[model samples]
Target: MILCVLVFVLSSTTLSQQHLSHPINFCSMASTCIHDGRGVCASSPDGCSRRSFLDQCDMYEYNCDYGTQFMTKVSNPCTDGQPDFLC
Candidate 1:
């Protein structure tokens, strides 16, 4: 039971890291209106080319400066064929 609990705790932490709520693709961003977030990487004010596997392939959020955290559970495959949609 202890082992199981420990494993669950560890896994949960890792999962959180992969699914933190925030803006993505900062490098390719075309806007800088975003304020900040867990996954938000200081906006470059250029919108964002950033992608991430923060949430499941289909289930994710688009937190543009926390104004709106859009969530979806489906996504088109990246042109580069990255599973996480990261270029």
Candidate 2:
């Protein structure tokens, strides 16, 4: 019984480590490509604000967690038909 408990503990710790060490990325769009909970870097959307943006595309390191919220810039298609207004 003691050995079984130790094995279970070890397995759980390994799993937790794997979960925490995973990389996350930010995709301008949500998809399976951003799976694995790693640090995801995303580029500015089509109609993003250039004054406060990093670049057309960005892939930065980030932590993965349930409490983390990602805000994405969206271009309004009804706008000037160009990547002008951000939604």
Candidate 3:
């Protein structure tokens, strides 16, 4: 009985440690895609500012990284007046 209790305690501790070391990642479940060369212009949710991305996939990744909800703009807001640049 004592040996069984010891084995159960060790196994439970090992299982808990393994789970903590390898937490589940929900982001990896998102579909992967190849980014096209075409550029994408994304505008802030409030539309006060904008940024450019390498492509649509880049824009999506930026949103995911920042926990933002920026959407693609029809035109490049970065080029409307200021010199061509990326932000």
- Per-prediction TM-score: 0.23, 0.22, 0.51
Q: Mind giving the per-residue lDDT tens digits that candidate 2 earns over 28-72?
A: 223323334332223233444222213222222221222232333
Q: Residue 9 of model 2: what lDDT?
A: 94
Strongest candidate by lDDT: 3
Residue-pair clashes per candidate: 16, 12, 0
Flag clash pairs in model 3. none
Models sorted by TM-score, best on top? 3, 1, 2
Better of 2 and 3 by TM-score: 3
Q: How many clashes in candidate 1?
A: 16
Candidate 1 positional error at 78, Å: 29
lDDT of 2: 0.35
Which regions of candidate 2 are displaced past 4 Å? 18-87
**Candidate 1 vs candidate 3, TM-score winner:** 3
lDDT string, candidate 1, 9-84, tens digits: 9989877655433455422241433433233222213323334333331112244343333333234222433233
Q: Could you tell me the lDDT of residue 10 within candidate 1?
A: 92
**Selected candidate, larger lDDT, 1 vs 3:** 3
